[model samples]
Target: MTAPLRPLVRIEGDTLVVPGLVSAHSHAFQRALRGTTQRAAQTGTFWSWRDAMYRLADTLTPETIADISRRAFEELRASGVTAVGEFHYVHHQADGTPYADRTALADAVIGAALDAGLRITLLRTAYARAGAGRGPEGTQRRFSDGSVDDVLRDLDTLRTRWKHHPRVRIGVAPHSVRAVPASWITALHADAKAHAMPLHMHVAEVQGEVDACLAEHQRRPVELLAELGVLDARFVAVHATVLASHEARMLGEARAFVCVCPTTERDLGDGLPDLTALRDAGARLCTGVDSHVLSDPIEEARALEMHERLRLRRRVTFTPDRGRTPAEQLLVDASVHGALACGWDVVNGDRETSWRPSTRINLRARSLADVSRDDALDGLFYSGSAACVSGVDDAAE
Candidate 1:
């Protein structure tokens, strides 16, 4: 029989100490759009909301992105996210021109994360055309690259520059099926495998993108990825809101991770994913604070179960097949699974992985006023908010 998961959660004094939370996917610059995009017309749908986000993306400079990212990261740290996967795509200038240094914006973002005291995985995104047979339009130009080679070269550059940094890891992200050609996905996967790096991609975030993929590739998004032979342990399919049951099984068979950004997905009116399908298929689950719609890692992780309960009209969804309890599973999804998705687990040789940070909840917090020690984790994850988190307890680390 397999041993149970260790270091589940420890209660010391009036605090509940757990592994530092992980936000496996983030778009830090979108923190600026939080209040503005909630209006009636701006949030009519995911596509309409994209219009406002695109406008905000165009207005950013290295200076502004740094400021925005710093604010986002600081809040994330305070809320118990010690590591983040910044799915950074804004590479060039407004008119699709590369900066003089080429890595200027990414540098700024990495610097900002460090400043906020968080380990960051810059998932440098690759955007090619706007869609099938179309060139990038408007703000997408800022995110697009000329060729697959360019993106790979940028990865090499980033790897070399940040090779020695203990807290920084670099991964490649193909923006989405609608943003990159199928050929690029194959090349990107090859490059990532050659380098032993993680690969992230936006998959099935919206029905329109899936429809477009079906129209062009004659296959669904995940099916195309499967045919391209990119599914692996290092592959992270983000915002997989509309995947088929078979696709979930495919990801499970490969031991791949599906990162659900519940706060951002619900905020943008995108549908929730099939959690039951993913879990039953054996796919690893993780969470992301995507779009900065909300910055609660606890909420993000709790939503995995809470959302499932609401969807299936059940109380608790996950069974302890190998004796990993539902709350323990949620903690895994919040912390280690997130770190694994960011290439933080096995990618960093001899370095600490997901266990690097530990956060504690204030037992005195109103959220846990009457909670027993055994149920503190459940209270922290479900009823408690980030407000209940006092801070990261570095001494516990």
Candidate 2:
């Protein structure tokens, strides 16, 4: 045979580089909860784990949140995430009172992202507590607003204040079906639409939330959202773990997006998302490292492909008639589309606003010259780990 291959950097015009990745649904604070929360099996289910999370939440000052977010964002960038969507809900002080500046916590998070050089979309959350129509639970006290109106007002203030900022975009999030009343979701949906902002929510994440919704509203969470006219193109339903077959169809029909956090779901025993079904039904798919348990975009993209592989017992689960390779299709669906889920541009060399940094995969200059772009991308998605990611930064776009 011939001699072995050589690695060289391939350049058609500028350089061979994939678009930077994004974490579409990050809870910056949850980076602290990974190993500590997972190792303790004594606490079961999302509810029990909430207690541990509550203690963690109670300990954060705005400064501490900023520090932790900077560190976390650094790790994310190093692992190839150039942008983040922070689903931030911890707004007020521990006693449910607004901080002196009101936007203190949100500002802290945005500052942290800018410090770490990652683009951020702050999805400020609306938390209207559930119970006997009373105040927030003792642990959740820091996360609530008196009403959806209060939450909307805070978001408006944030938008007005940060509209001119380059790296920060704002969105609205209603925490979940269990945490907020439907009235809040409806109003927030209206606010999101009027402002042309994306709406993010945790829908059907837990069985209990579904059961409670059915008991109270006579419909599942997705069904309730659909009934209330809250499901639409700008709406992103996170977890979506408990989507009914019909609800999945409806979600697709409505052109809504679904964010799957596979690592977090697996850690929490939250069950695998029906990715193939969701795709076939026409709903676009993206991923989130919800708890920051793992921040690898490759892993997230591969997890989607592999999960579908196991479910359907076939390779190339995401491949269609488009003639694109499985890996290319998955990368675009999982990474590029995921970035756009929170309104981030990829900024690759092909676009008019393409980011042209000196960064290169060096396929030809490294030990992979013979690796075709297709094979290189496949290896990147299927075989490469976070360790293979070389650099991340903002230069010019």
List TM-scores for all candidates, in order: 0.95, 0.90
TM-score of 1: 0.95
In the range 204-306, model 2's lDDT, one tens digit per residue, is: 9888888988987899988999999988877889989887899999888987889888888887878777877788887877788888888877788788888
- Per-residue lDDT tens digits for candidate 1, residues 1-397, read 4333355578888988887788999999999987887667756898889888999999999999999999999999999888999999999999999999999999999999999999999998999987899999999999999999999999999999999988899999999999999889999999899888899999999889989999999999999999999999899999899988898999989889999999999998789899899888878889999998889998998999998898889899878445766877888889878888888753232222236578888989998899988788777877888998888854322
Colliding pairs, model 2? 7-364, 7-365, 8-364, 8-365, 9-365
Q: Runs in model 1 with CA error above 4 Å?
A: 1-5, 346-354, 393-397
Candidates' C-alpha lDDT: 0.88, 0.77
lDDT of prediction 2? 0.77
Residue pairs in clash, model 1: none
The true-versus-predicted C-alpha distance at residue 319 of model 2, in Å, is 2.7
